[model samples]
Target: MSKNKKLDIDLLVDGLTCIDNYSNDGFVNIPTDKSALHPARYFKELFMSELIKDGVSDEDIVAELDLSDQNFEEFLNEKAMVTSLLAQRLCVVTDMPAAFWLRAQSRFDDFHTRVE
Candidate 1:
Protein backbone atom coordinates (compact mmCIF):
# COMPACT_ATOMS: atom_id res chain seq x y z
CA MET A 1 0.00 0.00 0.00
CA SER A 2 1.02 3.60 -0.49
CA LYS A 3 2.35 5.67 2.38
CA ASN A 4 -0.73 7.84 2.28
CA LYS A 5 -2.95 4.81 2.66
CA LYS A 6 -1.03 3.77 5.75
CA LEU A 7 -1.27 7.27 7.15
CA ASP A 8 -5.00 7.38 6.56
CA ILE A 9 -5.39 4.05 8.33
CA ASP A 10 -3.46 5.36 11.28
CA LEU A 11 -5.61 8.45 11.39
CA LEU A 12 -8.70 6.27 11.25
CA VAL A 13 -7.41 4.31 14.22
CA ASP A 14 -6.84 7.50 16.13
CA GLY A 15 -10.33 8.62 15.22
CA LEU A 16 -11.67 5.33 16.57
CA THR A 17 -9.91 5.90 19.88
CA CYS A 18 -11.41 9.33 20.12
CA ILE A 19 -14.85 7.85 19.51
CA ASP A 20 -14.35 5.22 22.18
CA ASN A 21 -13.25 7.78 24.71
CA TYR A 22 -16.28 9.91 23.97
CA SER A 23 -18.57 6.92 24.33
CA ASN A 24 -17.13 6.10 27.72
CA ASP A 25 -17.33 9.67 28.91
CA GLY A 26 -20.41 11.81 29.05
CA PHE A 27 -19.13 14.28 26.51
CA VAL A 28 -16.40 15.17 24.05
CA ASN A 29 -15.01 18.65 23.51
CA ILE A 30 -13.20 18.30 20.24
CA PRO A 31 -13.84 20.83 17.47
CA THR A 32 -15.91 18.10 15.90
CA ASP A 33 -17.56 15.39 17.91
CA LYS A 34 -17.37 11.66 17.50
CA SER A 35 -18.69 12.31 14.05
CA ALA A 36 -15.06 12.65 13.12
CA LEU A 37 -15.06 8.91 13.43
CA HIS A 38 -17.49 8.81 10.56
CA PRO A 39 -16.07 7.60 7.31
CA ALA A 40 -17.26 10.74 5.55
CA ARG A 41 -15.01 12.83 7.73
CA TYR A 42 -11.99 10.71 6.90
CA PHE A 43 -12.81 10.70 3.23
CA LYS A 44 -13.45 14.42 3.27
CA GLU A 45 -10.20 15.21 5.03
CA LEU A 46 -8.17 12.99 2.76
CA PHE A 47 -9.91 14.17 -0.36
CA MET A 48 -9.44 17.79 0.55
CA SER A 49 -5.79 17.21 1.32
CA GLU A 50 -5.31 15.50 -2.00
CA LEU A 51 -7.06 18.32 -3.78
CA ILE A 52 -4.85 20.86 -2.09
CA LYS A 53 -1.85 18.77 -2.96
CA ASP A 54 -3.00 18.82 -6.56
CA GLY A 55 -3.13 22.64 -6.50
CA VAL A 56 -6.80 23.01 -5.74
CA SER A 57 -7.25 25.85 -3.33
CA ASP A 58 -9.87 26.29 -0.62
CA GLU A 59 -11.54 28.80 -2.87
CA ASP A 60 -11.74 26.20 -5.59
CA ILE A 61 -13.46 23.70 -3.34
CA VAL A 62 -15.85 26.37 -2.15
CA ALA A 63 -16.73 27.21 -5.71
CA GLU A 64 -17.11 23.58 -6.66
CA LEU A 65 -19.32 22.93 -3.68
CA ASP A 66 -21.22 26.12 -4.36
CA LEU A 67 -20.75 27.11 -0.75
CA SER A 68 -20.69 30.71 0.30
CA ASP A 69 -17.41 31.89 1.76
CA GLN A 70 -18.80 31.94 5.30
CA ASN A 71 -20.40 28.54 4.92
CA PHE A 72 -17.25 27.13 3.42
CA GLU A 73 -15.23 28.47 6.31
CA GLU A 74 -17.61 26.84 8.73
CA PHE A 75 -17.32 23.60 6.86
CA LEU A 76 -13.54 23.73 6.95
CA ASN A 77 -13.52 24.66 10.63
CA GLU A 78 -15.87 21.79 11.44
CA LYS A 79 -18.19 24.28 13.08
CA ALA A 80 -20.98 23.09 10.83
CA MET A 81 -21.86 19.49 10.24
CA VAL A 82 -21.60 18.04 6.77
CA THR A 83 -25.09 17.42 5.47
CA SER A 84 -26.21 14.37 3.55
CA LEU A 85 -26.39 16.53 0.44
CA LEU A 86 -22.80 17.60 0.99
CA ALA A 87 -21.81 14.00 1.53
CA GLN A 88 -23.43 13.06 -1.76
CA ARG A 89 -21.59 15.86 -3.45
CA LEU A 90 -18.33 14.68 -1.95
CA CYS A 91 -18.98 11.10 -3.04
CA VAL A 92 -19.54 12.29 -6.56
CA VAL A 93 -16.56 14.60 -6.45
CA THR A 94 -14.21 11.94 -5.14
CA ASP A 95 -15.79 8.96 -6.88
CA MET A 96 -15.99 7.26 -3.51
CA PRO A 97 -18.95 5.31 -2.25
CA ALA A 98 -21.08 6.87 0.49
CA ALA A 99 -21.29 3.46 2.10
CA PHE A 100 -17.52 3.60 2.61
CA TRP A 101 -18.06 6.03 5.43
CA LEU A 102 -20.56 3.78 7.18
CA ARG A 103 -18.37 0.80 6.57
CA ALA A 104 -15.35 2.60 8.04
CA GLN A 105 -17.26 3.12 11.27
CA SER A 106 -18.23 -0.52 11.36
CA ARG A 107 -14.69 -1.63 10.66
CA PHE A 108 -13.33 0.60 13.41
CA ASP A 109 -15.81 -0.79 15.92
CA ASP A 110 -15.05 -4.33 14.86
CA PHE A 111 -11.32 -3.73 15.26
CA HIS A 112 -11.87 -2.21 18.68
CA THR A 113 -13.75 -5.27 19.90
CA ARG A 114 -11.18 -7.64 18.53
CA VAL A 115 -8.33 -5.76 20.15
CA GLU A 116 -9.99 -5.41 23.53
Candidate 2:
Protein backbone atom coordinates (compact mmCIF):
# COMPACT_ATOMS: atom_id res chain seq x y z
CA MET A 1 0.00 0.00 0.00
CA SER A 2 0.99 3.59 -0.39
CA LYS A 3 2.56 5.36 2.57
CA ASN A 4 -0.45 7.63 3.18
CA LYS A 5 -2.89 4.75 2.92
CA LYS A 6 -0.77 2.71 5.31
CA LEU A 7 -0.69 5.55 7.77
CA ASP A 8 -4.44 5.94 7.54
CA ILE A 9 -4.97 2.26 8.26
CA ASP A 10 -2.51 2.34 11.12
CA LEU A 11 -4.22 5.34 12.64
CA LEU A 12 -7.63 3.69 12.29
CA VAL A 13 -6.36 0.55 13.98
CA ASP A 14 -4.85 2.59 16.75
CA GLY A 15 -8.15 4.40 17.24
CA LEU A 16 -10.01 1.11 17.44
CA THR A 17 -7.50 -0.26 19.90
CA CYS A 18 -7.92 2.84 21.98
CA ILE A 19 -11.67 2.30 21.98
CA ASP A 20 -11.11 -1.21 23.25
CA ASN A 21 -8.84 0.11 25.93
CA TYR A 22 -11.50 2.61 26.93
CA SER A 23 -14.07 -0.16 27.26
CA ASN A 24 -11.78 -1.86 29.73
CA ASP A 25 -11.08 1.28 31.73
CA GLY A 26 -12.34 4.83 31.91
CA PHE A 27 -8.84 6.27 31.60
CA VAL A 28 -6.51 6.65 28.65
CA ASN A 29 -2.85 7.61 28.43
CA ILE A 30 -2.42 10.98 26.75
CA PRO A 31 0.79 11.78 24.92
CA THR A 32 2.25 15.23 24.47
CA ASP A 33 3.07 15.26 20.77
CA LYS A 34 0.28 16.17 18.37
CA SER A 35 -0.82 13.74 15.69
CA ALA A 36 -0.66 14.59 11.98
CA LEU A 37 -3.74 12.51 11.23
CA HIS A 38 -6.58 14.55 12.65
CA PRO A 39 -9.92 13.57 11.10
CA ALA A 40 -10.62 17.08 9.87
CA ARG A 41 -7.25 17.07 8.07
CA TYR A 42 -8.05 13.78 6.35
CA PHE A 43 -11.59 14.88 5.64
CA LYS A 44 -10.37 18.04 3.95
CA GLU A 45 -8.36 15.98 1.46
CA LEU A 46 -11.19 13.57 0.65
CA PHE A 47 -13.75 16.36 0.55
CA MET A 48 -11.77 18.37 -1.95
CA SER A 49 -11.00 15.34 -4.11
CA GLU A 50 -14.62 14.28 -4.27
CA LEU A 51 -15.74 17.80 -4.95
CA ILE A 52 -13.31 18.13 -7.84
CA LYS A 53 -14.18 14.71 -9.24
CA ASP A 54 -17.89 15.53 -9.12
CA GLY A 55 -17.41 19.05 -10.43
CA VAL A 56 -18.96 20.55 -7.33
CA SER A 57 -18.15 24.11 -6.41
CA ASP A 58 -17.19 25.34 -2.99
CA GLU A 59 -20.00 27.87 -3.27
CA ASP A 60 -22.44 25.04 -3.89
CA ILE A 61 -21.32 23.35 -0.70
CA VAL A 62 -21.63 26.55 1.27
CA ALA A 63 -25.14 27.16 -0.04
CA GLU A 64 -26.19 23.55 0.49
CA LEU A 65 -24.80 23.49 4.01
CA ASP A 66 -26.19 26.94 4.77
CA LEU A 67 -22.79 28.06 5.95
CA SER A 68 -20.87 31.26 5.43
CA ASP A 69 -17.66 31.25 3.37
CA GLN A 70 -15.52 31.80 6.43
CA ASN A 71 -17.16 28.92 8.28
CA PHE A 72 -16.69 26.59 5.32
CA GLU A 73 -13.11 27.68 4.96
CA GLU A 74 -12.48 26.94 8.60
CA PHE A 75 -13.79 23.42 8.13
CA LEU A 76 -11.85 22.93 4.91
CA ASN A 77 -8.68 24.11 6.64
CA GLU A 78 -9.24 21.87 9.68
CA LYS A 79 -9.47 24.85 11.99
CA ALA A 80 -12.92 23.71 13.11
CA MET A 81 -13.92 20.31 14.38
CA VAL A 82 -17.06 18.58 13.19
CA THR A 83 -19.96 18.70 15.57
CA SER A 84 -23.34 16.98 15.53
CA LEU A 85 -24.96 19.92 13.79
CA LEU A 86 -22.20 20.12 11.21
CA ALA A 87 -22.39 16.38 10.65
CA GLN A 88 -26.10 16.67 10.03
CA ARG A 89 -25.45 19.37 7.47
CA LEU A 90 -22.78 17.20 5.88
CA CYS A 91 -25.21 14.30 5.60
CA VAL A 92 -27.32 16.38 3.26
CA VAL A 93 -24.33 17.13 1.05
CA THR A 94 -22.37 13.84 1.14
CA ASP A 95 -25.29 11.40 1.25
CA MET A 96 -23.60 9.77 4.22
CA PRO A 97 -25.29 9.21 7.52
CA ALA A 98 -24.70 11.70 10.29
CA ALA A 99 -23.66 8.77 12.44
CA PHE A 100 -20.77 8.10 10.09
CA TRP A 101 -19.40 11.59 10.47
CA LEU A 102 -20.06 11.55 14.17
CA ARG A 103 -18.20 8.30 14.57
CA ALA A 104 -15.29 9.55 12.51
CA GLN A 105 -15.08 12.73 14.55
CA SER A 106 -15.39 10.73 17.73
CA ARG A 107 -12.55 8.43 16.74
CA PHE A 108 -10.38 11.31 15.66
CA ASP A 109 -11.04 13.25 18.84
CA ASP A 110 -10.44 10.16 20.95
CA PHE A 111 -7.22 9.38 19.15
CA HIS A 112 -6.02 12.92 19.53
CA THR A 113 -7.01 13.06 23.15
CA ARG A 114 -5.04 9.93 23.82
CA VAL A 115 -2.04 11.29 21.99
CA GLU A 116 -2.20 14.89 23.16
The prediction achieving the highest lDDT against the true structure is 2
Best by TM-score: 2
CA deviation > 4 Å runs, candidate 1: 1-8, 15-44, 101-116
- What digit string (tens of lDDT, one per residue) describes model 2 on residues 18-97? 32222222222222233324545545564545665777776877888788999888877767778889888876765555
Give TM-scores for every candidate, taking all chains together and pairing residue i with residue i.
0.52, 0.62
- Report model 1's TM-score to 2 decimal places: 0.52
lDDT of 1 by residue, 4-113 (tens): 22222345444344333222222222323233354445655667778778887878777777779998776665455556566565556565444444445455455546
Off by over 4 Å in 2: 1-36
| lDDT of model 1 at position 74 | 69
Check candidate 1 and list the clashing pairs. Answer: none
lDDT of model 2, residue 71: 88
